[model samples]
Target: MQKRPNKISRSRRKNSAQTIFTRFMLIVAFFILWIGGIGVRLVHLQINQHEWLAEQAQDQRRNQVKSKQLRGTIYDRTERALAMSVQAKSLFADPAEIEDVEGTAKKVAAVLKLKPSDVFNQLTKAKVENKRFVYLARKLDEDAAEKINDALKNTDLRKFDEPRFAGLHWKEEQKRSYPQKTLAAQVVGFSNAEDVGSAGIEQSQEGLLHGAVIKKWQDRDRLGRVYDETELEEDERELPKDVVLTISNSIQYKTEQALEAGVKASNAKSGMAIVLDPKTGEILAMANYPTFDPNRFNEVAPESLTNRAVQSMYSPGSVFKLITYAAALQENMIKPDGEIDCRKGFIEVGGHRFNDPHATKVMSYGDAFAVSSNYAAIKTALGLGKDRFYNYALEFGFGSPTGIELPAEARGQIRPPGTWFGDSLASMSIGYELNVTALQAASAYA
Candidate 1:
């Protein structure tokens, strides 16, 4: 019976052959479909979106021409440049290209006058995917930048000591330089790392000073010699226009001297003075004690960096007598020689006794001013009436900025006439209650 089974299964053998062939054909069809899908995707990426993808790839490596505007120069009345830009180089590195971050940072530190940690941090900040370069240090001297460029040569261990390892590729960027450290720092102002002005005349005339820089498509060879091929429009490289100031450097120096002496003598926290050409509105000299140098402005105290003569308002103390006396005389309430019998230097107004710091008896208006008698001045102001007196103070330019070309000018305050009663009127008359700026006092005197 077993011998008969060997010859009886021919149909079964045929069915088995068909099943194997069907599976083989199905596997071949699946492979063909997979290959066809891959080909279609390759065509879509290489041809359908080819231009846009090529542009994106080119943006990552191709040399791009960027126009850099040169910032304007500032000059004193003497036509000497108070502020100007000088060429400086910013150092950059490609972290992916750096073989040893720690060692490279040390070499950069040696050349750039920077900390090793700082350079390392800056180098590491470059995005691994998007960044081909990153700035290591900005505004470095050419000599230092050269030293760094040289240091990048040699192997990781030998580069610092070797002379030639510094030739690694890095991009150079332009930096703005200020020669004078802090002279006229508040007035001349400063530029950001990008060379944009933040304050003062630098801010006021920023448009005029920043000149046009022309950029055109350039061709480069293996030698990296960039040459312009096409007449890509006239990129006129207009230098920044110069700004002339009304300030006199010599007079400014003298005023600084005077202000320092006065500040020391008064033992005050801070002080300022401004001298103006009474005829013209030009500020002859504006001085603030404890001024900061413009060159290293970030190192100075923010308070000291302010031009107090323009930005501060003080009580004006005895200096305000000039305004009070002028108002009284103009209103015909008191003559220059008018006598006030301020016996014992005490006057009762609304139950408040107004007295001078040092007492005086009867005095003329001129003598009252010369002595700064608070009682006599109050008497004059009371006689003049608050309405007329307040108007006169306003007319004299108190409670207003002088409209000078400066930053942060403050307008001093005078209480409204409606708030003026006996005490306030008397207090204001003696220069005790009123707030006035140095500029306002000078203007009233002028």
Candidate 2:
């Protein structure tokens, strides 16, 4: 009976141990399954999340800028169009969408008057697989652009059933034009490809020239057809205001004719002439040698862009006598009949001999000026002293800008009285040793 009890006890213990072992194994298996599931989840997060996350990141990075497309028109005094933008077609393409690049490029180039090989290379070289858009040309005329659109309509280049190019990217941009051509080539100036003024009135009035250009975001389809977003605000196109100038065409033409003749006759490198109405400060005429036609400005040399009238300086020759005479009269240092001797046609001042083109035995201040007697003028200037002469020169607008609306006008020099050493006073009296612009001389006379 004792042996039977022990055997039963051992059997019960064995069964209990087996049950615990099975439970332990099951718990371990469940732990393994949980760990495997967690690892698979981690892999999915690391690998598969990037594409969706990257797309989200790109969406966040996308920004829209409201670009403006506004421009101003330039007009003459008569309200004629000198420069303005016109509606034109800007040609573009999707190279990857292009099936027959060579054939299409040939047709496009023929219509555009561009080289076929060049066009083919440009279109094909953008990308071999996935480029969406590339520009071929801008500002095509209506006729050529229409023909291109017609061809695109009938072609098999489109990915969808609709026309491929979406009827050419026709948009209006400002184009510079000089209607009168060379009438005021240097004055009106020219605009570059970007419609920015480079010089002349165009440069001075750039802010007025480029008004504004507003652009709104547009949604594009798979075929690249564009439509304005519903939420986009409307902005009216504001035309640029016209500028009235002090320049006149009639006198400008006459001056140009006279200047061309003078430039040829002088056998000089170049020449310029500017005629201003002194009473009103209006520029009646401004002309230069080797002038260019603003309409065909690209054909001209870069040097022709300069306006020589305001930019040049000369000695002013005998014309400066008026300044000396004016100084003497204004200072009351010499009357019109004031006596001065020039028998030997020379006078010694500061140990320097000054002579005149004409000999004056003895002449009055009036005769001295009438004949441009250099010696008599020198004596008179020396008597008037340096301070009065220099002061008068400054008053007449020497060594200063003429306040003309042109760029780069020269400021002629009048040496200060303190700097007038040795024979400078004597030489300056005869219009030597001092530099003056023609504009200054004319102002002095006026």
Using lDDT as the measure, which candidate wins? 1
Candidate 2 C-alpha lDDT tens digits along 214-306: 554555555545443433455665646567766677777888899888888988777777777879766766777778887577799988888
| Candidate 2 segments exceeding 4 Å error | 1-105, 116-144, 147-154, 159-171, 217-239, 335-340, 350-352, 361-367, 418-421
* Worst-scoring 10-residue span by lDDT in model 1: 159-168
Expressed as tens digits, the lDDT of each residue in 272-336 for candidate 1 is 77778889867877777787776676677888877777677778777776777888777677887
Q: Which pairs of residues collide in model 2?
A: 67-214, 67-215, 68-213, 68-214, 69-213, 69-214, 70-212, 70-213
- Each prediction's TM-score against the native? 0.77, 0.72
Assess the local accuracy of residue 271 in candidate 2 as a C-alpha lDDT between 0 and 100: 76
TM-score of 2: 0.72
- The deviation in Å at residue 7 for candidate 2 is 49
Query: What TM-score does candidate 1 reach?
Result: 0.77
lDDT of each: 0.73, 0.72
Give the C-alpha miss distance for residue 92 in model 1, angstroms: 1.1
